[model samples]
Target chain A: MDDQDQQLVFINWLEDHSASVMKVARAYTLNSEDCQDLAQEILLQAWRSVPKFSGKSTAATWFYRVALNTAMNWKRKDKPRRESQQPLIDINVPEPHGPDSSERLLHQEMIENLYQAIHQLPKTDAALVLLYLDELSYQEMAEVLGVTENSIGVKLNRAKKKLATILNGGCDES
Target chain B: MNLDEYRQAWKEDEAQMNITFDSDLLSKEVLRSHQSFQSMIYWRDFREVGVSLVMIPLWLLLGSMMSLPWTWYLTIPALIWIAAFIFVDRSRHPQRPSHPGEPLLFYAKESLEQTEHQIWLLRNIFWWYLLPFCISIMAFFVNVAWNSSDGLLGFSLLSGIGAIFLYVIYSAVYRLNQTAVTEQLEPRRDDLQRLIDSLERETDDENAGDIMELVAAISESESGCGACSGWLNWAENWNRLVPSWQTATAIILPTLAGALCGWYSGTQLQIPEMGPTLFQVIVGAVIPFEIVFFSICWSSSKKQKKIQVARDEEAASKPEDRIKTTSSDNGIRLPKAPALVILVLVIFLGVMAFVAIGAFFLHMKEDLNAHNAQVIKRSFHCTNRV
Candidate 1:
């Protein structure tokens, strides 16, 4: 209804979704500092873009779209051209974790494995996997990707298999 | 190891994470970048101001010289030199065409060609008009020196008329040959107009839509946009008449007083039957000031009238866009006393005129002494006459 109302809603949405998007962003960024920077950048884009949202898709879907677009474009453009290269973090999963913390460590290792597997996939497939993980409907994903829902469905199926193969350590290099 | 495990961990991290940010600090960076981007658009105009300042002295010097009552011999050559310089300047550094529809790589080529075509008309002012007039003036001076006043007067008038004729000719040539130059120039002008329009667009709380929408609404307004509005502002209020008036006065007043003094003093010197020389001194003095005074007044009045029309057009513009409450400096003072102030001004002018007349009388006496000395030296050398 007004600027203050819109800003409050945007901030609330940003706070709720920031951690989820930050983890996705971490999969691509190399270090703790880069992860923090990427997360802030995503938040910034969401702030600027919220005023223009037509609401054809859910807010989460729009957020995922902007985040993925910003991340992929940044990685592609920034990687070799920029001199300051900070590679992704090497998160070490310690042996069998502490006696009481084995489950949490195992869960962290699985998430790390998912991130590694996603990185090995082509950019478009990786984006598809990330959107699917965010639980965006096929139609909502289509709007973000600027493609048909049927096409998104097809891409998702192919991406899932690629991701599966990558996770299994039998990923096709091509 | 599985999707469920990854999902569960993601849920855990999402729930546990809490990040703090100071938005005002972050937005300051964003605002800084926007300001940087906005500042770039004015770089060219800033350069133009610098260039114009450099040209001001040169323009004033030439303008004053143009008003001098020296024999046509000196005036003609000076005009020619000025004409050549203008031609060279126009030819070498034409006004760059600032806009064309972009297919990016080809845009430069098309715009460059348009710039060239624009300079074609510019060249007409320099070469065809100014050059021919200068040459004709020189030719007239030579004819007058050879005892042909009728020929000199006829050719001088021809040269003056030729300047206008050349401008018309060139304008026609541009119309026929370079229609695209005119069309391409319009959009660049429009872009400036749009920028000005956007600046003035309402950011008031009552307005709907985003900044972009506000910009669009402003573009659609009857004032026909911001850049157009600025042009209207310039065309109306900034058509400076006073500078030309000052220039004309400076050149004319001194020379006119000098000529009348020259004639009166020369007559007193009793130069045997040289009525024409005395008349020449008087007419010469009066002609230059009259020409300069009348020319400046005519040009300034023409510009003023044109500006008045432009102002009227701008006044007709009604921007229904919500008015932005800018931090307007209210202390800008309008000049008081208006035309009535001229009563006091005339007193000062009269005193200056009297001083100028006195100076001219002194200069005329010196001229007479120099002439008598030359005649005495000639007489001493005339052995057969002695």
Candidate 2:
């Protein structure tokens, strides 16, 4: 495709699947401003790399690779934002307002806490955990992460147990 | 919480609101970042070339003041070397294709190649950089010696020794840089290589031409963790040749004894000039090494004393006086030449006195021996006087 055509195609691709990019950036960064910055950079990189696309893999596969690598690079380069900076905006995740609302709120809190725990992880481990949470099949994970399909089971199990420990210090017997 | 249950919620709850980027600005930003780095490298090279140009006249002035005809030739090669250094530095760093859009593999490969290039330069630096300079310096010294009528044999011997010493130091530094590269940067590069290879293996695409280009880019550098130590640090802790060299008894008494032994040996030799000259040269080389080591130790100890006194006063003083002074505001005081250096100087003067007396004695002995050797010749001399 011509450069303009490729750019248009990539933007359309981002509009459809850019949520994954956001997930990766949110998993990596601590604050909204940093997340927005990282997300923008990831899109910019994905757009720039369009010329080199071999097209053997689906755009989604390529996007994940680019996104994960960009997120990893961002984490590597930037220092942690100073803690004394204002505390993170509270998740005003819709106050419980109906039957079954309490359980939904609890699940929301758990997921928020899970993201916090994932961010605490070393960047590589965090990347693995993020892929697992995205529910990609082990074979798909292998393709995205360049791990053996067999090894994904072991890695995911380890990441899951670590996540469990991080979530509640492994006290949740269930 | 089992991770599988969270997947649906992760997809839904963490779904981000739409964000947009202007296309034109981003492309410029990436190119701008790359350009900035290139500019930095160019300026650094320009500064080095400028500094070398500035120093050329100073060297010529020195040569003229010293009335040396040969210094002009030396200056030309020195200027050429400065130019060559800039050229090699520029040419060695081939433009790394660092377009922001390139794969992580591209960057990893570039880093690996850059490190390898550094390793190559550092290892072979003696051959390409130092050898030519050494040759020119030896030629200059030889020419000076020939003009002055110094014995070629003695001059050659000293120059040969100096050449060997220079090579030994250079080789040692090269090996040290090499070891650091292998130990520190090599493994880091290898880890990166393994990651790249793993990614390639899964792709089933045989485009490992990137890997093949690595052959073109083969090199490494020790970022910091190396075994080299400063001279003072080495002497302070690693020195084993003379423990007493740091103490009053060792230096003072040995200074006197070395002088006496040397003077006695000179007097005993009776060969005018050669005996005393030999003693002076040996002592001369050793004295510089001794004086530097002594000064480093003396200066360090004096600083420690000053610090101790400061601490004691700080302990006794009110909080305001005891407020630790900022290093810049308190100014780093240069250490005075210790009384010990003066004592060493005195001992050196005494040794010179003894050496002079010994030389005089040798001359007197040679004169007397010649007078005694004359038999009938002396009687003829007396008759001429009458």
Candidate 3:
């Protein structure tokens, strides 16, 4: 494809599937800064990968594969540097506003707990949980992860169990 | 809440976190980043091949100027061989497949293949990169020493020293490339392999029912009152003082020591003035050092200023807005460099400027002396003819 056409397709895909990028970035990284970094990296990779879109797979599948692969590599590369330094402060959760503020706050807390639990799982399992949480079907997840549908089911069940353990463990401690 | 409710919340949060981008801006940013990345690889390839290409012209120029024997020119073909070898090898390996749209397993495997190829090139660098150049350089040195007034002893000594020096440099290059492969590339390759294995390996389905039951039980038993410990921010605190003096000393002392060592060696060897003088050598060395040092300091200061600005903005804004501001900044910034670093930089620049001025005057003086000698020789010839 020509550069303009390729770019047009990429921007549309990015707009359509940006949520997946954000979720993958959030699931893989520990902080907003790293999330931003990983998100930009995924975007760049996606932009580069646009010309290779063959219409064989859906754009969502292609973008997820790009983001997940980029996140996995990024996490591995950034591990040592992240481990060396201690964070000075925690990221502040945005205050819930308007009607049903308390309900929004509770949901926010659950989501935060969900992310923390996700962080504790193995990288691949974390990816599976993120895909599952995003409501990707077993077949879609299989295509993104390059595994059999049956394999996705088995691995994802195991990952979900591990995730539940972490979340419940956090709740009991609290 | 059940898994279905959690999915609902996830989708809700994803909606609330709706990030819109200006396609033009994003495209420009991506293009800029892609160009920078491509240029870095291009620069590295140029450095590797450009050196050999440059040596061909240099060899011819020196050969013509010195009136060396025809055999000395043979090294040109050897130099070409080295450059062509690198070019061909790089072309053969190519870059990682550009299509990241492939399955994760396939993409990871392609990446692993690229890393393994890099390791192979570095591991066998002696054959393609070093050996041909070594042979050409030795040949040139042997030809020069053979044609010199000093006889057999001088030839043997020159050839022996040349071989040893080349060996040291080539071996060091070999060792460094191997070290990089071991310390960096090999580990990355292994990581990719493991990732591929995990993706390709299927899990047993027998335990799927048990795991699903466990997940359901855990979800049903949850109270949903887990404390929302905030995510850790990645910003590093830059309030501590940097030991600028120690850093300056560490950089400056070794450079001065190396210059002194070079001077001492020159004096001890009573080296012939076939090329640059000590002053010239020092100037040549210091210019590159100053350029590199200044670039590093400039980049560091710029980075510090950016971080300081971001921090100031974050501090002034509401807590809820801080994440938005920082995330939009798109890069990690630290506080400005300590005053001591600036002070050291000024002093360093001042010293280098003084050295540079002195070298310029010395060069002018040499030119004036040569001009005077030519004038006197012409006058003597005129007087003799009269």
Candidate 1 per-residue C-alpha lDDT over B92-195 given as tens digits, one digit per residue, 9 for 90 to 100: 65433211111111222333344444445544554544455455444534433333223666656645555556557656765644454356444443443432
By DockQ, who's the top model here?
3
List, for all models, the DockQ compared with the true complex. Answer: 0.04, 0.09, 0.25
Across residues A41-102, which tens digit of lDDT does each residue of candidate 1 receive? 45555555676676766776677766754454332112111112122112222344466577
Better of 2 and 3 by TM-score: 3
Model 1's CAPRI class is incorrect
**TM-score of the candidate numbered 3?**
0.67
lDDT of 2 by residue, B187-253 (tens): 6566557556734454433232112112122221110001111222223332222243344444455
Per-candidate alpha-carbon RMSD to the true structure? 21.2, 14.5, 11.9
TM-score of every prediction relative to native: 0.37, 0.50, 0.67
True contacts kept of 2: 0.07
Best model per TM-score: 3
Question: Across residues A59-134, which tens digit of lDDT does each residue of candidate 2 receive?
Answer: 7657777776566555211111111112211222344578988887877676677777786565545766787776
Alpha-carbon local distance difference test for all models: 0.48, 0.54, 0.63
B26-51: candidate 3 lDDT, tens digit per residue: 66656655655455457657877888
lDDT of 2: 0.54
